[model samples]
Target: MKDVQKVLDWVVAEVGVPGIVAEVKDGGRSWFGTAGVADLETGAPRQQGECLHTGSSGKAFTAATILALEAEGRLSLDDTVEQWLPGALNVNGYDGNTITIRHLLSNTSGLFSTGLAPEVAQRYATRAGFRRHRFDAYTLQDMLKLAVSQPPVGAPGERFTYANGGFHLAGAIIEAVTGNSYADEVETRVIQPLGLADTYVRPAADISYPDPHPKAYSKMFFKDGTDLATLTAENWESLLEDPGLAPMDVTEVNSSGAWSAGNIISTTSDMIRLVDALAAGTLLPPAQHRHMWTTVSTEGGYWMPHARYGLGLFEFDKQATGGTPLRGVAGSLWGSWFFAIGTADGRHTMAVHTNTEWKSWDVLFKLIHAAFGLTIGA
Candidate 1:
C-alpha cells in the first residue's frame, strides 16, 4: 500500500499533474489514496469517492452490455452494421454490410477514429477551439459523418486501428435492437446489475461532473496532429515549462462526441469493481465471456504499448508489466486519464485517475507495476 502511495505522489511531484486518486483491492482488503490539489484555484485536495472521467474505459461497459444482449439472444456478435442501421455507412467508401459488431468492438472495423478528422481537430484539439467549443454538443451521427469523411484505414478486419467512431455504431445498434438509448441499456444491464452506484454516462448537454471531483486540465495544443507518441522527455519538460502554453481547465468539455466510447464518468472504487467483474467471468456467461477475451495484436506506439486489444478490453504483454500478465483498459481525452486492471481471477485490482491527460500512459505502467508488488522500473 505504501508503495502505491509513493507512485501516486510521484505522479504529482514529477509529472506535474494537478491531482491523482487511486484504489487497490487485494482479496477482501482495499486501499484508496490521493495526492496534490483537486482544484488548483481553491487548493482543494481530491477526495476518495470523487467522480472522474472514465474516457474509453467506458467502452468495456459498452461492450459488456452488448454481450449481455447477445447472451439473451437479442443480437449476435456477427450481425452486420447495415442490418441494424441501413445507410449509416454508405458514404465515403464505407460499406456497413461488411463490418460486424465484433469488428466494431475489436477495433478491426478499419474506420478512422473521429478524433483524427480535421474538423474535430479544429474544434477541440487547438487551444482556441477548445476554449470556444468545450461546451458544444454533438450527436452520434455528427461524429460518424466526420469519421467516414476521412479515408478508411483498411478493409474490415484488416488490422488493429483504434477507432472511436466504431463505438458510435455500437451505440446506434444497441438502440436499434433494444429500442432504448445505449446509456439506458448499459445502465440497466451492466451498471445497476453490478451495483455500481457511482458510474454513469454523461448526457450530451451536460458538461459537469458530480461534486467532490478534481478540476481536469489539458495543454490543448494538438491542432497540428502532434501525436503524444512522438513526444520525448525533453519535449514534455519544455512543453510543461513553456510560459505561453499554460494548462487549460478542461473539466467541462462536452463529451457527446465520444459517447459510448469515452463519456462514462466513475469513481476509482467503482472503476475497480467494474473491471473486477469484467475480468472475473462473473459479468458474462461462459460463451460470451470467451468472446470478450478473444484478442488481436495491437500496433505499438498507439493506445497502450505491448498490449493485445480484445472486445473493448486489452491485455498487456508480460514484457510491458515486468512479467506480470495484466488485462485492463486505459482511457484518455483532453482533461482526464484513467486506468483499471485486475488479475485474471479479478481478486486483485488497481484503478488510477489523474486530473490531466499528458504523459499518463508512462505513469500508468509504473503505477500498475508498483501496485502489483513489482519494482517501479521492473
Candidate 2:
C-alpha cells in the first residue's frame, strides 16, 4: 500500500498535473485516493464527483444508446444508414444503403475524419457567436449535410478508420428512429437509468462548469518547431456554437461532428459506475452483453483484444503491475483521462481520473505492476 501511495505521489509531483482521483475495489475492499488540484488557477483540490471530458470514451455511451433502443425494438443492429436518413450520401458511386449500424458501431464505416478539412476549423472558431443564439437548435440534418459532402475514404466496412462521422450518423439514426433528440435519448436510455447524474452530452460550446475544472492544453508541431504546447481554454463553447473556431475549414459540421463519437462528458466515479454496471450485466441482458464484448478485426491485423465494441462499451484488458489481470475502457482528451479497471471475476476494480493531460497510463500501468509485485512494463 505504501508503494502504491508512493507511485501516486510521484505521478502528481512529476507530471505537473492539476489533479488525479483513483479508486481500487477488490473482494469487497476498496481504496480511493486523490492527488493534485481540480483547478490549478484557483488552487481547488480534485474530488470524486468532478466531471471531465471523456473524448472517444463517449463512444461507449452512444453504442449503449443504440442497444437500449434495440432492446426496446425501436431499431435493429443490422439497420442500414440510408434506411433511416435517406439522401444522407452525396458521395459519387456511394449509397447510404451500404452503411449499417454495425459498421458505424464497429468503426468499420468509411467516413473520413471530419476534423481533417480546413473549412471545418474556421467555422468552429466563431463558436461564441452561435452560442449567443440558440445552440441546441442545430439538428441532425445539419450534421448529415457535412457527412454527405465527404467522399468515402474506403468501401463501407472495408476497414477500421476511427471516423467520428460514422458515430454522428449513428446518433442521427437514433434520433430519427426514436423521435427524440440524441442527447435526450441518451439521457433516457443510459444516463437516467444508470443514475449517472454527472454524465451528459454537453454541447461543444457550453463552457460553464459547476465546479473547478482543469485547463486543457494541446501540443502542435509546425514546420519550424516541436513540442509547442498551446492551451485550449473552455473554447468548446465557441467551437460548438460557431464553426469559425474549428481548425478545419468546414463550418456546418460542428456539434453533429461529435455526435455519438466524442460528445459525452463524465466524472471518474460515474465512469466507474457505468463500466462496473456494464461488466456486471446490470444494463443489457446476458446475450446482448456478451455481444458487446465481441472484438472486430482491424485493417492493420493487430487485434484490439483489450478493446472490443459492444452495444455501447469498449471492453479492455490490462496486465497490472502485480501481474493481476485488469480490464477497463479508458477515455482521454486534451488534458483529462478517465478509466476503470478490474479483474474478470469482478474481484478488483479501479477507477482513475486526471485533470492534467499528462500520460497517466504509464503511471497507472506502473502502479498496477507494483500492486501485483511485477516489474515495471512487465
Residues 1-378 of candidate 2 have per-residue lDDT tens digits of 566667767777885554677776666676677777665556677665666776677887888888877777888878888899887764655578888888888777777655443334433233232234323334566566665555676787687656667778888888899888888988988899899988899775664444534444322112222111221222322223222222211112233346577767777667767777677767777666665666554435222333444444544433313344344566554456666665555556667766643353567666655554544334
TM-score of candidate 2 to 2 decimals: 0.75
List candidate 1 segments past 4 Å from native. 223-244, 319-323, 374-378
lDDT of 1 by residue, 1-378 (tens): 888889888889988888888889999999889998898899999888898888899899889999999999999999999999899888888898999999999999988766656677567656766788888888777866766787777899888888888888898889999999888999999999899999899888988988878899887465344554444323434333343467888887788888988789888888888888888788899999999999988873255667889899998766666776678877987878888988878999999888888575668767876788653235
TM-score of each prediction: 0.92, 0.75
Candidate 1 residue pairs that clash? none
> What is the alpha-carbon lDDT of model 2 when measured against the actual structure?
0.61
Return the lDDT, model 2, position 321: 33
TM-score of 1: 0.92
The best candidate by lDDT is 1
Q: Which stretch of 10 consecutive residues in model 1 shows the poorest summed lDDT?
A: 232-241
lDDT of each: 0.82, 0.61
